[model samples]
Target: MQVRDATATKSVRQGWTGRTRVALVVALVALLTASMPASGVYADQSGGDNNSGQNALNAQQRAVLYNIARDTWKFYSADVDPNTHLPLDNIGPNGKRGTYTSAANVGVYLWAVVAAHDLGLISREGARAEIAFTLIEVAKLARDHGFLHQWYDTTSGHVIRNPGDIDCATETTPTFDNCYFISNVDNGWYASGLIVVRSAMPELRGLVNTLLNPMDFGLFYDSRPQTACNVNPAVTGNQPTGQMFGGYYVGLPVEQGSNWQHYYHNGALYSDPRISAYIGMGLHQMPGDVWWRSWRTLPPKQCPTDPDFSWQGQWPVGGYWQVYKDPQSGKRFNVWEGHYTYPGSDLTFIPTFAGGMFEALMANLVVPETTWGTKSFGLADRRAAQVQVKYTTEQLKYPVWGMSPSSTPDDTGGYGGYGVEGLRFPYFGSGADASHPNLGLSQCHGCATEDVVTPHASFIALDVLPQRAYTNIQALRRLYPDLYRPDGGFYDAVNPTTGGVGHRDLVLDQSMIMAALDNALNQRKLQRHFAADPASAAAHRYLSFEKLSIADTGNGDNSGGDSTGNNNG
Candidate 1:
């Protein structure tokens, strides 16, 4: 399937008004100040106490987010040609058609819809209708060969490509991989879209099945072991062998190979905690829960450490190790621990995937007890039980937060080093107070660590659950609001070192941010029942977007002006 940019008939630039301009300036200034090199404040300082005087500001923020979601919905919905079931580009001034169907863009649009609904920014019915219509169109676009092309002409559901064109106007290869490499990001999006469809529309269960079932795609591997680069080179080289060994259980051999085929990294493999976190979450929504079980069953292994004490694997080594070891091995594999060649010793932080997977598992912890009827396998059962207890306890503790040390090669402060003596607590003792300017709220050592603020880190923080994840969410929301446009779009980077917002744009960043916000809001709602005091209640309400407003101004005057507008430009 061909992928093409949606045509821009009219300039969204004209939609910006003076008020938006002002808001943009103010917001940008605030963002810039927050990220200023001297400003070393961590965003979420209070662990679980949300009773700060920031309720009003929090409410305003929620309103802004809701408005952003609303604007996104209107933009996409308006572009969609109801009759053809295909989405067009932005509407031009004088009512002209701008561009054609964009598969990737539409996928993002659908996710925004899902996120809005989850955040309570849109009514359930509204979300359902939008998703239903979009899914139907998407289903129609799927070729008989099971590959979904990147773009289609909105006027006619036929696929379209860029101008340069190989065999222009004629059908080209109909493979998803052909459009993009077989990377986890692409697979994650495709998987996530399917999961959303399954969750929202039960009747469309077949679509989920279609995505899960592997076909005769040339890249398909039937049973392969996977490994990250930090593992023994012998183990890394035996990835194919491991996959072959585990072929019976894992079905297809998923390799961790990438263009950068080195012992330190894997391009094809997703090492970022954020992506893995979402993948784990999406896996929970699948039928029979094979992916979730596999994830839980996969033995963790130790490898050389990296700067952040975390490592993203390059190959499918964990699965292979598990197959060889046997299901009943009951061994705890430390996947993050890798033996690197040089300058790779600090990779001992908790498994990056742990936070994300833990978050997903927590979200679904309340799956009806009936769903667990008489399941076998002691480890699996035990893991579920542990997750249940942890999730239950966490929900009882609303606005949860975690306290961990940042990675700094110092005597008292470092990635794993608990600050001198009793300073390990949330508000790291008096020394933290004296050294860090933002009080405990902004000056935690962990925030400065590499893993805590990378795209992977942001992904993990946004996707995972537990108090720690929410704390990160709250921190980002407060500290880097500028990175997120008031219109539900987000710039790609948020500098962890300086807490500054980066100037890159990617549909993934916006989509992921929305997803994280949606998850946080949902968690807040779930934990509300356990609130014991007025403070907790306020905290829950504060994090919630339910009371937010989504009405549009006369022009595209989002209160924070077009910070995200110039992003695409």
Candidate 2:
């Protein structure tokens, strides 16, 4: 990871530009109109089509969404150690425990719950109970030191490892007994969680306050450790050990010069500003102090490299490319590294975090009124034109959703057969050559892809379910209108070779995409009926297309031919 000055580029701070905004709005309207059905309008039918009708509809829709969420909660929340409320790691395949208990995961879940409640998906009571349960569990681990551990073994009701340890069992004890051992990513999730929780439980203002206070030990920013520092007498006091490669010594008193001897993995050490920004803006609803300061300071101090200067391209800031220059190599790396798709369903925090940031900004009160458009395709419309652009671009560039390419094996004998076309995209499905439709199925012995159809279906389903873009819903119908099966259930997986549907199990991702889509559709309704904006109407109109032409036909199935027609519907 490299550190660079925030002043490096003006565009970084202002991510959404005027040109991009206009383009997005236009594209979204066009895409939506092309995909949705014309017969059904998203207007409120109750109370003579006035604001009151819209409100009633919004309330009704919220109730329905809440019920749906409640049904799905059972799958995530189960019998954990009552004390820890963390699911046992051994409960699932490969002994993976409590998959959804991390701060980031929980934060997203909390946001979803909050969104559902606000949209009227769950009862107030239901929302409160869920929040209470989560807070209670989090409180159980609120140690005197203030920071939470990386995770708690739900089955054992104990902290399992220090935060960010490569191996959980390697270092059992804390190196520095500080409460804020957590990183920016975890803090972002925590801050977002607090924001939603406080929104619902206003009475918990003090609790929220406690959680927000950075110095009170409630939350601490996990700093990079000086790995080379060790408790060695050779480098202690005045003894000059010739063996001191970097002349660094660990465990030296903070007052001594040795405090600066610790070697960070990367040559640079700086506190992450993004985390601070989220907490300041999202939790406190105020400007961030640390982030602002970091912004002013841009890059931080640089240190000498050691053998331990390892960069694990997994974390959001660490992995992604920014303006920051690599200290070891002056060359610039694109931020899109480590983003290659694989077959398995391994979860990463970057996409979710980025998506959450976008969602939060859209939902925030600070959003400029200029951004809000009265026309269905205007700026104020949540279902703006850019959405279509994003969807289309992502679909074309990435193709598959959810599944990773690495999960598939090579052409030679490996767990899963390799050289499959769709592997690069994040979709999981039965392995078969599209060119050779009669071939037998291929499987990855060690890494089996999750149900394939979930990703595609969920992706499409989410686009239409949300109310922000009635046009999007309409466009979806027009482009891929015939997604629903004859049995009323939508196809989850489709074997392109045989055109078979519903041959896989539905997972949490499927539910999430569906829920998000539903919420987006309901939002569109609110904007149209309650907000009474023309942009909302246009969005609906925009989506009501009769047919969508597939521009790019690369399916990664090694198929040479490209098919485009009304078959999608």
Candidate 3:
């Protein structure tokens, strides 16, 4: 299928003049460091709470993760299309490759290959060959402003129209030429992987840069701050929007300032799409204030007509409105310092789109948010992990912990979103109300259910909850041995009630397992590789320096964040 790119591809450096690039850098630094107080400051000191947390894996834990990585790599080793080098989205019980792949699937596969080599599962030469083939085909695939379309035919590497996609073609009929939309989060993951591949295999740098450099992250950036907080049209007037959009339609007029869908602002800071903002800032495609634009929870505003008060999140919302100023334009933003609390507890944390483990931790696989924002994101990351553990094992009385989106655990083939229902916001497409306390096990109403305990969630938690993550994996094997597939790695999802498993291997899920192991086993090798990118340097301060208002509500204490360290044994 022939497709024209929205923007002509350029070299890694793009054609921006040196002066223009320097001005972007100046603007980014100003946003990160030059914030002046309007009413009260955001308590923006530096570092994260529990920054020193996360203990090293022990001998037994290392053996466990090593074996898991070795087994998980087998899925990619066999499931990839040899002619195209692109991985199929999944392999079902029939042991046949699935039809489609996404920017997220390919994105994680890039790092999976690097992780295999880093873990000694594959040689450097083998890893480079695999990555090179993938990039060569990717360069041939159609893209929007250097960003690949969301879905592509896995076998042929052509953009396909999927009706089931969250964002798909505007055309009613098949128009493979330029059918699909470009998703900010999907492309962010893809770009993040290229960043890792570029660093891990230096020999593949030129080919990788050919694909990575030209894709400007700024294309998806919605730089304007929103006029209101919650879903209130009247109060907000809904005009001045901010942050990144959910996605973009390459067919629609843009790159020329036609703001039709900029209103689809992904307001939450902890959502998966935050990766786009990170990459955009690093590339100087967006300003640093973009970080300040996303909501921890769209502050508990006076949207009285809306149900569940301002936001349909957990009750007794806790936070303050902290104002920040733009140094260049002198514009002020009333950033919400708000957060959600676990019912009957003071465990305060920022919520994700659906309270899924991957949503909270997927970006953590590459970006060192935990280390960079120890007081801010770092503290919230650790608390979120611990909350999942406590909620599942202690409250729900499940033998194993770790809740995330995965395939339905039933024998019939299916897929759906699963997460800690209490850990999300109903206002943000999550069925996260206190009334229903279902873990990722049984299907619930309203919230996108098919809630099954995905092992990948525990795997992703290796960075934050070192001890619990390791022990939980052991318990999973002990309680539900069928979940582990020694030959093809662990299956995707499991039913904690029954010994049922999803009996499938997904590229994205398996890749998360590989990446977490890569960092956990190799002393954060994947994160370090991505950190070396020039974009990472540009956004380091934004990640590192911040003091969030997420505090313990049990005793009404406001120590800023939980400083218990990285829950290591």
Highest lDDT: give the candidate number: 3
What residue runs in model 1 are displaced by over 4 Å at the alpha carbon? Answer: 1-108, 142-145, 150-185, 203-219, 222-347, 350-460, 463-506, 524-569
lDDT of each: 0.32, 0.29, 0.67
lDDT (Cα) of model 3: 0.67
**What would the per-residue lDDT of candidate 3 be over residues 83-194, giving only the tens digit for each residue?**
6768888888876568688898889999898888788876554565556657777888878678888688876677776623333334554332336467888899998998
For 272-374, candidate 2 gives per-residue lDDT tens digits of 1233333333232322222211211111112232111111111111122233332323433222211211123211111211111122122221111112312
Report clashes for each candidate as comma-separated counts.
45, 83, 12
Cα shift from native, residue 412, model 2 (Å): 20
CA RMSD per model (angstroms): 18.7, 19.5, 11.2
Which one is best on TM-score?
Answer: 3
Number of colliding residue pairs in model 2: 83
Q: Which stretches of candidate 2 lie over 4 Å from their true place?
A: 1-71, 77-83, 86-100, 112-123, 142-145, 162-181, 204-276, 281-569
Put the candidates in TM-score order, highest first: 3, 1, 2
Q: Estimate each model's TM-score.
A: 0.42, 0.40, 0.79
Taking all chains together, the TM-score of candidate 3 against the true structure is: 0.79
> Could you give candidate 1's per-residue lDDT for residues 1-569 as a string of tens digits?
11111221111223644345334534533443354333111122123322123221245555554454443333443455655645553343244454554544455455556666666555544455455545555556644234445445665666555412332245443322223222323333444455444444333444334443442121222222334432234543433221111111121123443321321121111122122222332233211111112222123334443111111221221122222111223323322211111011111111223222222222221111111111211112122222222322233231212212222221221123211111122332322222431111111223222222322123323222223333344565566665444432433344433555443323333444455444344543212221221112222221221110111111211223321121100
